[model samples]
Target: MRIEIVEGDITVRPVDAIVNAANSSLLGGGGVDGAIHRAAGPELLEACRELRATKLPDGLAVGAAVATPGFLLPAKWVIHTVGPNRHAGQTNPALLASCFTESLRIADGLGARSVAFPAVSAGVYGWDARKVAQLGIEAVRAYAGRPLEGEKPMVELVEFVLFSEETAGIFRQALEESGGGPG
Candidate 1:
């Protein structure tokens, strides 16, 4: 398995799946969410509305991913995961972590070999870049290095696509200091 950090748009990744930093409503909003929704076209919104109609649990918060067609994206599927805001406090770290955990679990189940993710909560969710990078690095390291159930599925690439140079620096520094990430 390999973990890569890059500064770009996660919605455009050609990987098997790209995880979206979605809200509980699953409705299109600003930042990465809006970009993804726009790039994926109207079909994604239709799909999300259909999923929302099923009545998901409230406070279910994190690692709760649902797959939808990629539409215009190169990826075959989009995995929507809700991340917690930092205002919720440190006790909420696990909720953010679960986004990665659940995203990967869904990917593993879908036989996705490669997945790309945005900085899940750093935008409207208000997560600090450094902390999010640290947590994200640990999460990816813990999972990306090994495939679930010893089944490779060729699951070798995991990408954290940063939108800013500052965030990219944070991720790089974290990965460097910990001696973690794809070589």
Candidate 2:
């Protein structure tokens, strides 16, 4: 698998799927969730509504993920995962790591070759940027290292797409430290 860090908008990344750091409601809130919802258009919201009305009536659990079609965005699918809120007294690192792990698992199930992820829980959620980057890159690297039925990983490329240069740099450094930096 190829892991890279790019400083840009996650909405426009031409990947098969992009991970949204969504709230548990999946109804679209501030930060990356709102941006993805707006870019994916009303259909995305409808999809989330459908999920809530059916499979996820009680809303998505933190660290778990669900996928919706990317209606008006460059990507084909959007993988929504709720990150653990640090300020809410949810400071478990495993929860943060699960965000990346679960998203990749969902993307793999969707037969996605590439995925873009934001700095989940880094902003507003009150998680430290460096810790988020470290945990995220570590989780993705561990996931990529695991072999599937074909002895190869399903997700070929994982891009840490951050809107802020500082966050992007942090992820870049983390990727390098993990020995999974851009090829």
Candidate 3:
């Protein structure tokens, strides 16, 4: 898979799938989650609440992602993954990795060619900037080798949207360093 890091707004990406920086509640809280819910309109809330009704655990990840009425957002589907909240230093970077991995698994199963992902858990989850980027890149690298279910195993393009220049530069440097050093 071709993984690229960019600094931009995740809501306006025209890719086939966009990952929401969702809360464990899945009810669309603040930050990126709020913006996505607002742009996607009210229907996303109803649909998301229905999914929440099933009593999904905080660690459970799911993903085809429901359509949010193409009038506002350009993407066809919004892949929702409940990312972990870091209250202290107890947050699991591995679970955060799972969020990306699982989202890609679902997207690949849906035959999605391109997907946009915000810096998962980095905003509110309190992961160290460089560590989060390393995990994100690692997850993408792992997913890149495995094709989605029932697909012919092709390279899925993954984009990590950084909210600031610092994060973007950190991710770029991490990728460059790791890419040349047997990551």
TM-scores of all models? 0.89, 0.96, 0.84
Q: What is the Cα-based TM-score of model 2? A: 0.96
Per residue, candidate 1 scores C-alpha lDDT tens digits across 5-74 of 8998888788999998988888788888899999999999988887777765352356577788889989
Which wins on lDDT, candidate 1 or candidate 3?
A: 1
Clashes of each: 0, 0, 0
- Listed per candidate, the RMSD to the true structure in angstroms reads 2.1, 1.4, 3.6
Per-residue alpha-carbon lDDT of candidate 3 for residues 43-87, written as tens digits (9 for 90 to 100):
888777666665553423432233233235777778777666676
lDDT of 1: 0.81
Residue 134: error of model 3 in Å?
A: 0.3
Please list the C-alpha lDDT of all candidates, in the order they appear: 0.81, 0.91, 0.72
> Model 1 Cα RMSD, Å?
2.1
Instruction: Write down the TM-score for model 1.
Output: 0.89
Q: Of 1 and 2, which scores higher on lDDT?
A: 2
Candidate 1 residues lying further than 4 Å off, grouped into runs, are 55-60, 88-91, 145-154, 180-183
